[model samples]
Target: MARIAVIGAGMGAMAAAARLAVAGHRVTVYERSATYGGALGAFERDGFVFDTGPGLLHLPAVWRDLFLKTGKEPLERCVGLTEVDPASRHLFADGSAVTLPNASRAGIVSALESALGAGAGERWGDFLGRARDAWDRSRRPLLEEPLWDDWQVLGRDPYPALRQRRMLRTRQAATVTEVGALELADPRLAALFEGCALAYGLDPRRAPASAALLPYMEQTFGSWYVAGGMRELARAVYERCLARKVEFGFGSEVTSIVVRDGRAAGVELAGGAVAEADHVVAGADTALAAGQELWEDGDVRPQGGPDAGQLPGRFAVLLGLSGARPASAVHRSVVHSPDTGAEAAAVFGGRLAERPTVTVLRPDDPRIRPDDAHEAVTLTATVTGHGGAVDWRDKALRERCAEALIDAAGTAVEDLRARALWHEILTPAETGAVPAPSLAGLGGRYLHPANSTRLPGLHLVGGHAHPGGGLAHAGMSGALVAGLIVEGADFRGSQ
Candidate 1:
C-alpha cells in the first residue's frame, strides 16, 4: 500500500482521497482553509444558506459511480436525485423565453422549434446526438482512466485503444461558438449558448469543441439539486472520506511540495511543518502550484497558445433574496443581455464591454430548498484580470460594475433588491482566496496552449486542465488524474 497525500479538500480532492483510500492506500488530505468543501462549500447567515459555488449538480451518474467504487451509495447518504423539469429557462433579448425540458430531447427540440423555427428542433437533435457521441467516447478513456502512465491497466497507446473503443475525436466536437451558431437557429439563441461558455471563464471562440458536451450533458442526463443545497453533495463526499479513514487536516495551508531525489517526498505546511508521504497528489489550484515550482523535474505551467498568460479571471456575484420570484424556475435560470456574444468575448478574450451576460440559479425544488420562506440566488458573470490592486480594491469601479450587472438582469433584480433579506457581492479577488482559487488567474495557471506544463508525482484537476471548469468535469478530472497516477504515462502518451 502506498502512503498517499492528497492536497485540498474540494470535491475532486475529496473524491480522489476516498477512491485512493478504498484502493488500500493510506491517504490523508490537507486543506488550506477551515472548511472542507472548497468551492462546493456553503455559508449560512440568519437561516439563509448560500452555496458559494456550484449550485446545481449535473450527470449524477458520475457521482453514483464514484460512490459505488468507494463502497457507498449516493442515494443512501443524502436526498435521492430528482429530475428537474425545464432543465433551464433561457430569456433572450427579443422578449422571448423558452423552457428546456430535462432529458427529453424531443421536448427540448419541440420547444426550440416553437420558439425559433420549424427546423430548429431537428437541428438541435442532430447537434445533441453528436455531443452524446463525444461524451460516450471521451468518458472512459479521457475521464475515467488516468493520463496514460499505467501501462498494464491502460495498455500501450490508449488513444488507439480508445479509438477502437469508438471514442469521438476531439476535433470533431463543436467549438462553443460553433455550437451556439449551429444548434440554436436564432442569433439571440446562439448568443445564449455562448454565455454558457463564460461560466468556465472561457471565450466561445477559444473554448475547445469538446466542451460542447457540457450543455449536452445537462440536457441528456439532466441537472439536479440536492435537498438542502448543492453543498450537501460536498458534505456527503466528506462523510465518505471520513468513513474510509482518510485523515483531513483543515486550516493547514501547504506552502510547498517538497521534492527529494527526483520524487515527491511530501508537503511543507505554511508555517514549515513537513508531512511526509510516499506519493503526493495536489488538489490545489494548478496555477498556484505551477507558480511555486514545487514538483520534481516537471513544471506545473499553463499550457496552450502564446496569449495564455492574458487569460481573464473567473468572476461572479452571489445574492440571497427574501422571497422567491414566481417566474423563476426551481433549478436554474439564465438571463442574457442583448449582446451576449460580445459580452462573452470581452470577458474571456480580455476585451472590455459595457454590458455582461448573466446566469441566475435559484433552487426552488422542495428537496433542495426546504425553507420556503426565503430564496437563495446566485448571479454569475465572468470578468478578466487577477483580483489584484487595480481591479478588486477600486471601490468606485467595483460598485459601478456590480450595479451594471444587476441592472442588466432587468427588473427582477430591482425587485430582488427591494425584497432582499441579505446579499453579498463576491469578486474574483475574494474567490482567489478560497482553498483552490475559483477565479481564473490566481488559483491555477491561465488558460493557454503552449504555456502548459506537467509535474512529476503531481496532477491538476478542475478548471486548470484540458477540459477546463465545471463541477462534473472537475470531479471527472480527479478520477482521470488518479487513473493516470495508477497507470503511469503522460496524458498525450496514453492516447
Candidate 2:
C-alpha cells in the first residue's frame, strides 16, 4: 500500500483522505487550523454557533457517496435528510418577493405562471431545460474529471465534447446580467438572478451560465440545513474519517510540496518538519503553492494576483439576534441592488461600490431551530480586493468596512444592530487571512486559470480549480482527484 499525505482538512481533503485510506493507502491529513472542515466548518461565538463557511447543503448525494465509498453510510451516521422547500426567497429592489419551489418542470412552470405571468413560466421552463441539459452533459465528463487533464476525457468523443464546448462558449455570452434580462420579465425577478451572482462574489455580467444550475439543483434535489448547524455535516464527515483510522495533524500548516526527481515525495510543514509519502494530494489552495517559490516544476502556477481568474471576494457580518424577524425566511433571502453589473465591475476594478448586492442567511430554519430562541443571521456583500489590505492588524479599517457592509444591507440590519446579542464582521481580507494557508481559507484564490501549472502529486480539488467554485463542483472535483489517484495506482500495477 502506498503511504499518502493529503494536505488540508477541508471537505476535499477529508474526502480524498477517506477514499485513499479505504483504497488501502495509509493516509495522513495535515491541517493548519485547530479544527477540521476547512471552508465547510464552523466556530462558536458568545452563545450562538456560527458556520464559518458553507451554510446550505445541496447535492448531498456527493457527500453520501464519499462516506459510503469509505465504508460508512452517511444516512446511518447523521440526522435524516430534510428537503428545503421554496429553495430560496428572493427580494428584489422593487420590494417584490419570489419563492422558488422544489418541484418538477410542470410544477415549476405552473408556479412561475402564477407568480410572474403565463409566458414567464414557459421562458423559465425553456431556460431550465437547457440548463439541465448542460448539467447532464458536463456533470460526468467536465465536473468529474481532473480539470488539469480534462482534455484527455474530452478527446474520447470529440463531437459531443465540441458540442459541450459550444454550449459553454455561448453560455458565456449571456452573462449573469444578460441572463437576468433574457430570463425574467419582472424587474424583481431580474434582480433576483443578479442577487445569485452577488452571493458568490460575481458580477451578473461575468458570472458563468453554468451557475444557473445552482437554482436548478436546489429546486430539484432540494436545499437542506443540518440540524443544530451546518457544522454537523462537517463533524459527521470528520467522524467518518476517524472511524476509517485516518490520522490527522491539526494546527500543522503545510508550507510546501516537496518534490524530488519530478515526482511527489511528500510535504514540508510550516515549522521545518518533513512528512514523507509515496503520493501527495493537496486539498490546500493550489495557487498558494503553485508559484515558483513552492515547486520548481509545478504544473499549476500563479499567473497574477490572488484573485486572478477567480470569482470576486466577499465581506460578511454575522449577527446573533435577541429576537426573530417575521420577514426572515427559512433558508436564504437575497436582495439585489440596482445596477448589479456596474456595482460588481467597480469592485473588480478596485473600487468599493456605494451600493452592493446583499445575501442573508438565517440559522433558524424552522426545521433546525426550536420555537423559543432568537435566530442567527449572516449578511454578506461582494468586495474588491484591497491589494492585500485584508490583514486584520488594520483593526479600524476592518471595522469601518464591516459597518459599511451592514449599512449596505439596509434596515433589516438596523434592526439587527439594535437587538443583536453578538456581532462579528469578516472582510475578504480577514477571511482570506485566517492563519490557514493563503488559498485554504473560504475566500482564498478564485478559479485558477486554464493551462496553469500543477504540483507533482498535488492536485487542486475545490472551487479554486476549473469548472469553478460551489459545493457540488468542489465535491465533484474531489471525487475526480480520488479516481485519478486510484487509476494511477492501477496503471503502476500493470507496469
| Cα lDDT, all candidates | 0.62, 0.61
lDDT of 2 by residue, 145-196 (tens): 4433323332221111111234456332244465666455456655655666
Displacement of the residue 371 alpha carbon in candidate 1, Å? 5.1
Off by over 4 Å in 2: 103-107, 148-173, 183-186, 285-311, 324-328, 365-371, 386-418, 433-456, 489-495
What's every prediction's RMSD, in angstroms?
6.8, 6.1
lDDT of 1: 0.62
Query: What lDDT is reached at residue 406 by model 2?
Result: 67
**lDDT (C-alpha) at residue 26 in model 2:** 90
Best by lDDT: 1
Model 1 TM-score is: 0.81
For candidate 1, write residues 1-495 as lDDT tens digits: 888888888877787788778878898899888878777767666666667777778778767877887884655465555667768877777777777888888898999889876776776677677667666755554444433222223211111111111245332223556556545546765665577656655566745555555667678788777777778888888888899999999988888877777666788888889989877877665543434453333223344321353445544555666665575444566777687667765664545457777667766654333267666667767776653334765667677777776665553344766766555676666665211112122122322111122445665655455334567756766666555555555543112
Angstrom error at residue 265, model 2: 1.0
State the displacement of the C-alpha of residue 266, model 2, in Å, after optimal TM-score superposition. 1.5
